[model samples]
Target: MSQATETLVFIPEDISSARSGAFRADWQMRSLAGETMGTHWSAKFSSPEQLDLQAIELSITQNLDTVISQMSPWETDSDLRRYQKAASGSWCAFRPEAFHVLERALSIAQETDGAYDPTFATAVDLLGFGPSPHSGYSYASPEVQQAFAQAGYQKAALSAETNSLFQPGNLRVDLCSIAKGFAVDLVCQRLRELGLENYLFEIGGEAKGLGCKPDGLPWLYEIEPPPNAKASLSKAQVALCGLAVATSGNYLRYEQRHGQTVAHIVSPRCQDGDDKLLSVSIFHDSCMEADAYATALFLLGAEAGLAFADKRNLAALFQTADDLLLSGRARKLLG
Candidate 1:
């Protein structure tokens, strides 16, 4: 990593609540702060908007966690549960903002042909991500498979006028589709509002770079598989500016099932796991789009993913398990 000309590590721990998914904020900022006079703003900043953004993020995450997380039994009592309680019924009222996000998710799902949707709640649930936090894997009933199999986001209905979301609709909305990317975008908005034009906004592995680092050069980062794997960036680096970059892969999120490696990413068409394209990195004007496409591309496989990206004029890179980075339209954009 090249030295950052100047860096600011502003982590207002006391001012911020721990709702951003145990992020790499502290350590990442510390790494950037090494031997620098950059201020670490763990204290409440002077700007009210900064505090407000933090609060909003925490609240949104909590509300989302309420729906998606099986952590607490009571969270099932939420609007999502309301739909489940209908006992083979009709539409229902939902939190307006939640519904908005859900509606967006469904739109992406429709556009992506179910590649990105809340329907995966069942797939993820079976993989051990609910109330227990990490359920690993479990033997599920055929009936359970049938139940979840029917839970596609397309089944849900949303009225912009009513601003509510519900099932056909027996499904619930999960924003694993775009929540982290949304949060990154929101943080960028907040930073811009605070006159912090030059900053890197990141949540999860999704990140957006704005302006240059305190140094004059553009912000740069290498792509690597999740930790525990040996260094895999191939000594290649991408400079990020005014764009979001995200990577999704299977090696780190796989389990042995039926004598095969069952990964988190389920192909909506095959209902099977796709392992050919180990990782996909996408860059776009919106982090949400980038994040969404990263997953979508992974599901698309190499040939189809390139075709989709080319058709959309999207810039993307797909890394195979063998460590070859294949750029689709993205190669020209990086220049």
Candidate 2:
């Protein structure tokens, strides 16, 4: 077993510094939560007088459901499932939101050189992390090899004008790496539409914040440390003002095979998983980007990931059993 040996401290900055105006003092803090995407979704916002909490909650749930209906691999009728079953060279149309997410996922895949891929549904399922139950397929098994051969972001084509995706036979798309963060963004959009400017929105652990709290303080979010971290390691917290933060770690989801731990986050380039780096956390203006980058960085492993983050100027923190690595941008932010 390994332990986290260092800490990064982040001070909460004034939200008004990032926004145009100060928050109103008369507003009250309100919270609403519900289940979505097989996990919980929550909101903490500065509510205006006479605001209808129930109606807002309903709208948030509906928006989350919309993402599931379009992107969920578990949903048989989802747009992704439809595209998966489409014949080779056929264009499958998608709703605007889903199309946008798919487009972004592919972009990240290309940027990372396929370290992160959305077309790994079959591989994911065989690795015991997808919609279907695992069937004892080893990494070197023929079934797994065939699934890997079929998974590649470049194999699919996107049409920006038509909002459609081209299916190349047996190519399955899974947005699990990025969809939850998109849901958080969608919820935040709804909140803004209702004139709520100060709030924190989250789905599954990916989160975003807008403006300030009712007390004029930024929303403080605690970064989750790796499971093997030392108890004495000081905790890290970030001021989520006009920003989103996402963390991905091997401990979040895994399985034991042949007395070794196998993480759910598989590297498409390697066609396998590596748990050497405990986790990676990324901060960005968009929760979706933060989420995808976290996965991509983790797959790239510690040294390469840190270099990539620095080159890209991404605020990223990578933690392993005995070491902690931070990009130049992450150091500036934490310092």
Candidate 3:
């Protein structure tokens, strides 16, 4: 059997090497993990002398539930689903949290010329990649075509002052590309409010870190190499310090449609599966930005994607069918 790629793996560090001065003498390395958004999440941090694991876990779960309630398209009562069901040409009162995500998603979509779009909800459902999977969905069907037609970021307008959103068409927004990363950042924020630093936060494959270990060493992460025949997850690791990382890969999350295999990622330009690149990883100060850009660059393919990252001096790594490429800044970070 071909092993599935690990995608992202935590690299354990020797506690002795971490800086100790910032923490108490009794400080200990601790790890916490849970499942959320249909995937697992984890956190590692150096704790001071006293910490309440139970309270922290409860807070984490509550925050993640709030995130899902606001943005998950899978939930019928979610704010996103409510917006999708809203009548066209009507402005709906939007939750500030959901609007924030949409605003950032729209910004990235515009920057990438619609490569990373939040308006793929219908396409996602038709492709059997959404909460409810269906067989026999076709890209050529009128329903699917209509879904494509509703997919322009320009069609959605946000009012920051009123916290309202206008859907100009039958547009339905999906935040799968960026919500998890935003959730990770929120969890990190929660930790900060509790007076904790030196933590690594990850949900699904999106991750962010702040401060350093007790010994003051940055968290390390292993980005699986280009998938192989066996599809094992083994590769060189990178160190991340006060940064965030997110990756998009076509090896997994695929479905069979019309007797052909297709990736789950939907491109706004093609309104179909994007298959040009094998994988792309993005590093940024904000996990949300990294998550959205990773999907965007993957859809842009190797040449244009690399150029995009290079022009912005973004830290990114791209893996193609035949070669591995890194943005100049990413190369330096990896080096």
Candidate 4:
């Protein structure tokens, strides 16, 4: 058995003791047919990059973040801002690749029946989303609330002709859905640039493992099913066959405010629904896809989310807040 161990290495901090800033990246490898890797992360950049390894990490991640920034409604000065400022409904042009990502978001939105939406920016904000400073943006639209209940991601029109978007000005999109996965893609690209084929890339809770580790083994990841579920309750080995894994749940983000346990995972379609299911983990061909899908599944709650996964033929694990039986597909994946 190849032993897997993680060590935090910094080029600036360790080598030169420079005060540039802290950059966080993980490089854990093992040598064997298979090995296990585990990391706990929160999505988003905390500090800065100040090391050689950190510089390499920044070069890749910053580019990835740029792609997501162009997609996020959260950015005040973003290219997306033009649409928000459109006098009526204006055409918002996107880079071809960026447009493709939006197109993909729309596609997944359709596949999930708008259950996993990218256009939840307004709803998310109204529910007091964003970082610490920008809190408490309330919802005042019975009409808007109704809109969310029957929200269809198809409502937004994309013009590959103009590389633009046409939707209600209030309709904003957030790439947090698939951005982490996309970041993994960028990270992998950079790893290739650095001639690193055997490495694991994890951002927040999303992960993408490429090739074998330095220890020479397939990457081993742990699966955390929803709490109180029959699936592996604690950390255990999961087969890592070049797949990216992501989990979405409200267990950590919940806060009791004014008698309501407000969770950040908002249903782009529901402003107020007591979603009981705790968390959902998805395995997919790519980390980005899996990340977005898992988040959407978590937002869909227990029944609808599971149904959506079944329809898509994706493998997943779902654990509700209280112990509940999962369908055949989820059970098998979690097991």
Please, what is the TM-score per model?
0.70, 0.92, 0.87, 0.72
Tell me the whole-model lDDT of each prediction, alpha carbons only. 0.55, 0.81, 0.76, 0.58
Candidate 1 residue-wise lDDT at 234: 44
Candidate 2: tens digits of C-alpha lDDT, residues 29-53: 8899889888888899775566788
Model 1 misplaced stretches (Cα beyond 4 Å)? 1-90, 132-144, 226-233, 267-274, 323-328
Off by more than 4 A, model 2 = 1-7, 11-15, 19-21, 24-26, 268-274
Candidate 2 vs candidate 3: which has greater lDDT? 2
Badly placed stretches (over 4 Å) of model 3 are: 1-26, 229-234, 268-276
Full-model lDDT, candidate 2: 0.81
lDDT string for model 3 (187-260, tens) is 88898898876788888778887767776566776666555423352354555556788998778776566655
How accurate locally is residue 308 in candidate 1, as Cα lDDT from 0 to 100?
Answer: 81
Q: State model 4's lDDT.
A: 0.58
Write down the lDDT that model 1 would get. Answer: 0.55
Assess the local accuracy of residue 5 in candidate 2 as a C-alpha lDDT between 0 and 100.
39
Give model 1 RMSD, 1 decimal. Answer: 9.5
lDDT by residue (123-198, candidate 4, tens digit) is: 6665666422545433434533653654457768988889888855566666667766776766666665765544
RMSD of each: 9.5, 2.6, 4.6, 10.3
